[model samples]
Target: MIESAYIHIPFCSHICNYCDFAKVLYQKKWIFNYLDALKKEIQLNYQNELLKTIYIGGGTPTALDLEEFKYLLEIISTLNKQKEYEYTIECNVESLTEEKVKSMKQYGVNRISIGVETFHKHHLKIMNRHHTKEQVVEAILLLKKYGFQNINIDFIYALPNETIEEVVSDLCNFLKLDIPHISTYSLMIEPNTPFYLNHIKTIEEELDFSMYEKICRTLKKNGYEHYEISNFAQPGYESKHNLAYWNNAFYYGFGLGASGYIPEIRYTNTRNLTKYCNGEFCFNQEKIDFKTKMENEMILGLRKLEGVNLIQFKQKYGKEMDSIFPIRQLQKEGKLQVHNRYLRIPEEQLYLSNEILMQFIDT
Candidate 1:
């Protein structure tokens, strides 16, 4: 009953300083071989289920040349797609050409998430991202010209030395676009990324918190629902594929470094390209137990603004929330509350949700 799949293309024309995803410079030889491996992996694992959503993420999936992008699409065409499926691809404005956009349309791509980290040229250079503001404008205009309206633009705030004014400026530009979806993330200098290697530090906590509050307030005022902690969407445009993950549903993850979840198992593909291409797709997997599943159910479900459904949880897991976890304690602490039958974190306390969620870890 897996209804979603995430395909990864670990090839980028230029590596951004903050990115640590499994990726390498776009090499023609590697691209062809990787496509072969990806196709084989899908053929072997896909059970012909009519997937409701398929997300093609990167290393910039649109970085491929015109012919290579077409071949990749052709490979994806073999999947059993639902009548009204959501097929999304991650793209960078510089490489997402007109031909690629048309090819995506022909292959049933209904959504395109662009990597416009920030609108400021100085911030772009600071993050080692090459696309200019004008390029992003052209890219969006082009996508709209092709009748693709379900678009999302990613933004990263809390950069080293980043100010609230800069973040406000970026949001101002984003609001003008009138796009349906937006995903914003705070800067975390994870180990192994160029930012980490160069000793980049995050912004002050107060500023970071302020930036988050600003983003939430602005997007909500502009008629976007704060569906998730980092995602805002206009009613019907929330990413179905991502919602699958937060809902604790199963999905297939294909390609090097991709992760997937089945009925009781979660697996991640190997990051080593050589091993991945040689048919060693998954390197780590864990069989999930009932206790683990329940914990995951709470942790993942609580991420949504609406939180988890009480009766649905009992029906699915055969246990009430109070019987399985300390719901009353969280409720007493004012961290979680029930609203219209849904147990959710209060809007003001969402920023501290991680601390509250940790209490249910092993209960």
Candidate 2:
């Protein structure tokens, strides 16, 4: 069952030097045409069932003008569901406005994810991000004023030239907010990004790993649950929309560069904006075999802090997690711990989880 929907809006006001997400510079005419095509696509795939969640992420959804934003929201409001579902909209800090937030609230959006990557102006400029810290504060306050209660602030840590003190200071800035959710990630120098081209020196491996642990401890001390690899939420405020993805549930993905998984197939659309905009859709689809599915179950399930449920895996796939897996091996090596029915990597091994999880795959 397609219980979740992920819609991509591939336009941004300006490409941040560090961003690698599929996006093109904002053009008024391009947006109008692209939006029309997007709506047409949505109508064609519109399922008249109550979805469990809907996530509207983008290069920067807030970059659109009030009218364009409204047009997009009005189109998505057509979702027919049995109950109120989680509807999340990602917004850029500088572009968010009170009116835009109000439009989202009226259109049934229950959560607003603001990209406040960091709280330092110098770090912002260094990253080539255009938003000011004060602007993020304004956007957050605006969302609250518009009667939205569930707000999630996205933070990035461990950037080049970042020190432990600086990271903790950034956390302090985020802590001042009343928001219930925050997602943090170590800034990596992705292969094709400008940061990589400029040879931006990332933090030391050990230091970066230490920072990750510190964040978990601090956030937990501040009364948040470290639920997933990159997510922390106050009790009962975890992102349900992302949870569906983490759970490997079927989701409908729309717009160019988006990916969808239904039944045995997983596919991603073309990344070429021109080709996608020209109505020539490209999909890299693959049928997942049993071996692949089991591998995914092991790797993705381990991403959750609570790890995989042995009984649940057996019920879903008709095999014990430890039977065809090396659970005892990982435990013997001290990389993983088996508690009750869940097998999870130790908190200290989280940064090296990719290395640990790879052991479950068939080489």
Candidate 3:
């Protein structure tokens, strides 16, 4: 059964230079119509299963005004949730308000993931993020004041012309928030983004690697678990919604530009807002064949620190993992390892995971 759902709210007050996600500037004129379309889409797709997690991600879900935000929450309330469900909403410091926090608390949103990419003023300007460090601190304090402790802040490292000290300083500022989760990402200049259009270059490969290493060391030393490749969290605070994706589990994705996996089909909604609002929900879908399923099993499952479970693999696919792929060979090359019956990429080799995961393709 699909136990997770991700809803995308594709409206932001300001677009970040590095963002490539499907989103548009917030317009009050479009808010009600978009929410109505979102409600229709969810009603059509959701099977009424009790979901363990529901993540409302962005283009800054908090960009909506209080009434609009509450309307969005009302639409989400239709989903049947488990007894201990985790409901998360993405926020930006500038858009998040005290009234919205109270609304989220009342509507059962237990998790808040903020897009505080960098605390450095120069980096913030470069990314077109306009929030001050004080605003971020105030947002966290406000969330905490409302008893919302399962907070997460995104951190970006390895920007163009960024220094190691700057990265470390950002980390220090994040530490002061004392939140439970941090999702760190190395800057990638994707096509069509403002960064790519402006010819912004990434930092050197070696320096990027060093920054990743430093982040891992510091977060680990400070009692955070490097549970996934790009996620660090205090124990018991891991993102259940994201874990569903990495585990290759089925989920419902509602709203424009969202992608979902359900049973044998994986689908993405239309990126065109006009098309989506007009009820043209699906843009593309691919049937998951057996070969592709097994490949995804390896590629996605190995992302976790514990890796994939060897026994579960056999039980699920009715074949030994080594029989289907080059598991034994990768193990011999020290790219993979078996620890406590879980097959995983060794911690030291995780940075090269993309290269290693490619081997499973077409195997």
The candidate that wins on lDDT is 3
Clashes of 2: 1
Tens-digit lDDT track for model 2 on 174-243? 8898789999978877878888898888888889888898899889999999989889999989999888
Give the C-alpha miss distance for residue 51 in model 1, angstroms. Answer: 0.4
The residue pairs that clash in candidate 2, if any, are 50-81
Q: Which parts of model 3 are misplaced by more than 4 Å?
A: none
lDDT scores for all predictions? 0.93, 0.83, 0.94
Q: Which pairs of residues collide in candidate 3? A: none
TM-score of each: 0.99, 0.96, 0.99
The residue ranges of model 1 lying beyond 4 angstroms of the native Cα positions read none
The per-prediction CA RMSD against the true structure, in angstroms, equals 0.8, 1.4, 0.6
Off by over 4 Å in 2: none
Q: What is the per-residue lDDT of model 3 for residues 24-102, given as tens digits with 9 covering 90 to 100?
A: 9999998898999999999898899999999999887999999999999999999999999999999998988899999
**Models ranked on TM-score:** 3, 1, 2
Clashing residue pairs found in predicted model 1: none
